[model samples]
Target: MASVTLSGLRKEYGDLTAVDGLDLDVDDGELLCLLGPSGCGKSTTLRMLGGLETPTDGDVHIGDEPVTDQPPYERNTSMVFQSWALFPRKSVIENVAFGLKMDGVSEDERRERAREMLDVVEMGEFVDHDPTDLSGGQKQRVALARSLAIEPDVLLLDEPLSNLDKRLREQMQLELRNIHDAVETTFVHVTHDQNEAFTLADSIAIMHDGDIEQIGAPREVYDDPVSLFIEEFLGDTNLVDATVAEVTETGVIADTAFDTEVDVRTGDAAVAQGDGLSVSFRPEELDVERVEGTDGDGASAVTGEITDVLYRGSTVRFYVDLGGEHLFFEQSVGADTAFSAGDVVRVSWDPDDLLAFAADGARVGRGET
Candidate 1:
């Protein structure tokens, strides 16, 4: 296991910067995920680390050694692609042993090590079966076993479960986490799947337009995003316009665009009077009911008419019209009560649950709160 570091790492294609001045530190034995949409340079960053692509400038270091000049084989890092890339003619055991064989290990030791790795990946029973006869998940297991057999310093997985169906993909995610824990290698995975990143990553680096927008644990980044892009991108949230009305010792007070002034007290922020700002709160944070009054828990309330309702399995999504503006609220149905479309309701939430961001979409610093 090793810690990987990139300093001012850049990659360009003519005038376009595919990866711009990227800097990151992936701790030893940590599973760091490079998460972003397509064309955000996540794959390019992973490739640069694996020595598959060279950076236009800056350094790639493993431990204390700068490996920007080294080749993939010389860097001692093994990569698993989205494609399984198993040999069709080779059985699982043979495929697992292929790398060790090429590295000049004795045949007896190679088979022993390959068998052990297959067992780790829960594919020991299929050691003698041809990979062509295996299902997609089984083939991916074989590929994982093959990658593990080499005992590389770092393991790079690029959307390793993208080819599987939903159920299989979910199952493989746990399996992959198990493999990582068993081996304890530094894993850097790249994917666009939000839940995949949240489930598997120790820390996530959210990239946008060839730059990192935020890097934090799943809950931290989700609950307190640093930008409007980060807030909306992480999950579904309500972004309502508001203005700073007053400042208090506990937090700040703001007036919403809908003529409703509420005491949104929380921590300090870089806000001033009359400054235009935006408030973000998740749908699940709101309390919805059929009245315009507060639930008497110091909860701020916004009353509106339910314009639309969509059933989504366990929960229902409600579109509330606050005059001309629309607010989305997600309510989990229980035996206690239920709601439907065209119902006039009041949405209540605590002041602490409200997040403040600047009009320019950047997060207000907590120091100024």
Candidate 2:
């Protein structure tokens, strides 16, 4: 296993800059993911790492060696594409052994290594079956076996499970993690699926428009996104517009519409009074209840009418109209406290769970809230 690094890596097509000065490091034997939407240069970055596409500038390194100018064969890495790219006429064993055959490994050793790799992927029984007869998930497994048969320094995967159905994709995500752990090889996977990235990656670099917006573990990036794009991209959040009401030693307080005051913990960044700030909170952190007569918690509670309720099997999501702006919150639905639409609820969350961001939606400080 070897670590992969890209420094100031770029790829341009005339006027269009596909990958722009991207820098990242994949730890030796760790599975890292390059996650983002389409056209975000994830695929280009992967191809550059695999030597399938040369960078316009910067360097690519595997282990301690600079391989920016190396051809695909010279680079000690294997790539699995989205389309599987297996030869339909080749049997499973042939498909897996193809790379070794090209490398001029003896036929006996090639078939033996192919069978061993297939066993690792739990597809040894289908070694003699035709590739056309296999299902989508089986084909992907075959592709994975083929990539692993070469025993490269790093494995690059480009949405290798996108062609499968949802269930199969989920299953493959687990299988891929197991394979990564078992092989102990550096893996760099690219995908737009949040669940896939969160589950499979030890570290994730979330890219946007040819640049990495945030790079962290799944929980770190999800909880403390650095920019507006990240906040909206990772998951659902209620971004409330508010102004800094006061700055205290502990934290800064913001007052929003409908006389709702929020306490935002300032981690390290200092903010002054009247600073334009936005308070961000996850729906799961909120508690919604029927508001009673006066004397409610001044800083915590916000009186709002539940405009709609969506019962998602595990949780219930509520859309509350607080004055003109709508806020969303979620509750763990249980047998008791079963709620429905048109419920006038007071929404409140733990002060420790509130995340405060700049007006531009960039997180200011780091804390529970």
Candidate 3:
């Protein structure tokens, strides 16, 4: 296993910059996931690490050696692509052994290593199956086996499970985590799927544009997002626009679009009256109760009429119309309260749970009491 590092990494195409000056470090035997939406330079960053793309500026290091100038084959890394680029003409084991064969290993040794990798990936029984006949999940396993057959120091995975069905992809996420544990190879996985990153990564680096926005364990980043982009990208939540009405010793009072003035616990956040703020109300943090009249009493509670009710597999989502603005909350389907459209309800939450962001997309307060 080897620790990987990137310093001042950059890549540009004519006038378009895919990767800006970015620096990152991957610990030995750690699984780090680069997570972001499309065109965020995550794949470009991964390619640079694997020596598949040369950085326009900056350096790449593996372990203690600088490898910016090294070619793909010269680096001790293997990449599993989204396409599962298997050889249609070769058997499963032959495909797995192909990399070793190219590296000048003897036929007997390469085949033995291939069998061992196949077993590690739980594909030992399909050594002789044709690649064309394999299912999507089976193909992905074979591709993984092929990459692992060479015993690379750092394994690069570029959306390797994106092609599988939802259930199969989820299953593969767990299996991949197990495989990483068994092999202990340094892994750098790139994906835009939030759940996948949460499942497989020892740490997640959220990318925006060409640089990393935030990096931490799954729950750490999710629970304490540093910016509005990070908060919005991590999951679904109700973002309401508001303006500061007054600043007090305890917190700030903000007039929200929900036709109510709410108290936000802004921990040492610099703000003044009339400043615009985007307040996040996460669905799970909200408490909802069916009400008859529009009058709701409390600084943290507001009365709204249910506009729509969506029945998800295990949870129900409700959209509420407060004045002219909309906010939503969710509840498990087995919950006792059964709300429908046109039902007036009171939506309330703790002031500390609200995360406020300024106009510049920076989080206003730490939300600490």
Best by TM-score: 3
lDDT of 1 by residue, 252-300 (tens): 7778876677666545665788988888867878877787443432328
Query: Poorest 10 consecutive residues of model 2 by lDDT?
Result: 291-300
TM-score of each: 0.92, 0.94, 0.97
Would you give me the overall lDDT of model 3?
A: 0.93
Cα lDDT tens digits, model 2, 277-299, are 77777787888778664356567
RMSD of each: 2.5, 1.9, 1.2
Model 3 lDDT tens row, 216-242: 899999988989999999999999999
- Candidate 3 lDDT score at position 311: 90
Error (Å) of candidate 2 at residue 98 is: 0.6
TM-score of 1: 0.92
Give each model's whole-structure lDDT.
0.85, 0.87, 0.93
- For residue 140, give model 3's deviation from the true position in Å: 0.3
Model 1 regions lying over 4 Å from their true place: 245-252, 265-268, 292-299, 333-335, 367-369
